[model samples]
Target: MIRLIWTLSAHTRYYLRRYMPTNRLLDEIRRRRNLKWGIPAMLLAVPYLLIASICTNALDQGAPGWLHLVVLWSVWNAMKLIIMGPVSLLLLVRARIAEAVARRGGRRDSDAGESVNHAGAEPLLHR
Candidate 1:
């Protein structure tokens, strides 16, 4: 059992390392992007939350309003998990691609001896 658990853990770690952002800053940006999506998601849920609260309170008079609230909360959390995971992942992948492109462009520019700051202009030589 321990061996199996260890193997699974190692595999999961490897997978995450391969797929997730390698740089610390990029990882942080991914987390912040998730939070940015999450905060507005919770804000948008306010109306449904109010509805659930009303239902729960109304059930105090003797009904099953708690059921509605339970379902609402469950679905809301599930949807958030489902939606945010891919969106944040997409952002991280995009950042990685952009970084790769910039690195490639930087190498090409340096090799060609050109500065993007001055396009098609004469080279400046200091004596």
Candidate 2:
């Protein structure tokens, strides 16, 4: 049972080393890409605002009470978008930070060609 557990743990570590992204990729992408909160902010806000404006215009046409209700719905949706957009953007930023940290750690591990062990001992493995 102990051997099985050890083998599984070793395999997991090996696969993690083989597949994870290196720090170089993370650094290059982070440097090249501007994380634009404005783009996402506009994306989240603009469509709903446009729809709300159109609905308001339609309501002004004096069509019916149902159309007024539609306008109200549009306004509510717009408000929801405006409120949630920032929250979503914050979540996205956090996700990127986490990804960067993982990539950096993985790259360091790969460069050292040493798995971080519980006992802080470096073991040379045959690749």
Candidate 3:
């Protein structure tokens, strides 16, 4: 069952990737997602959520049933963008800290009272 779902998703992605006109822009966004550009990308969710809200209003006004699909797709994309913002921020922070550490002679911090054992070279605490 899960395999079937996975295969279906793969095929759907294949077709979408092949036909989507904005594939290049999406690829660029994905490539730079962990950079400063990602923070502003979170704002893209606002438009999606607005679209979903508009479609939902239309549905309430007796729009066609198929409008639900647009609402669903908009909400889902908004959620993905919203989530990616904070995650990318965290990743950026970690990358910056690693770069800073590397610049500072790349010495890993160790407690002053810790001793390394010869057998495993693992640290042993004084306590």
Global lDDT of each candidate: 0.59, 0.59, 0.72
Quality of model 1 by C-alpha lDDT: 0.59
Ranking by TM-score, best first?
3, 2, 1
Tens-digit lDDT string for candidate 1 (1-127)? 9999999999988886567432232344356344345334434445655666666766776776457766576456445544655566666677778889999999998967766535766656632
Model 2 residue 82 CA deviation (Å) reads: 2.1
Which stretches in model 3 have alpha-carbon errors above 4 Å?
A: 1-6, 15-34, 106-127
Best-performing candidate as measured by TM-score: 3
Can you tell me which runs of candidate 2 are displaced by over 4 Å? 1-63, 111-127
Of 1 and 3, which scores higher on TM-score? 3
RMSD over all Cα atoms, model 3: 9.4
Candidate 3 has which clashing residue pairs, if any? none
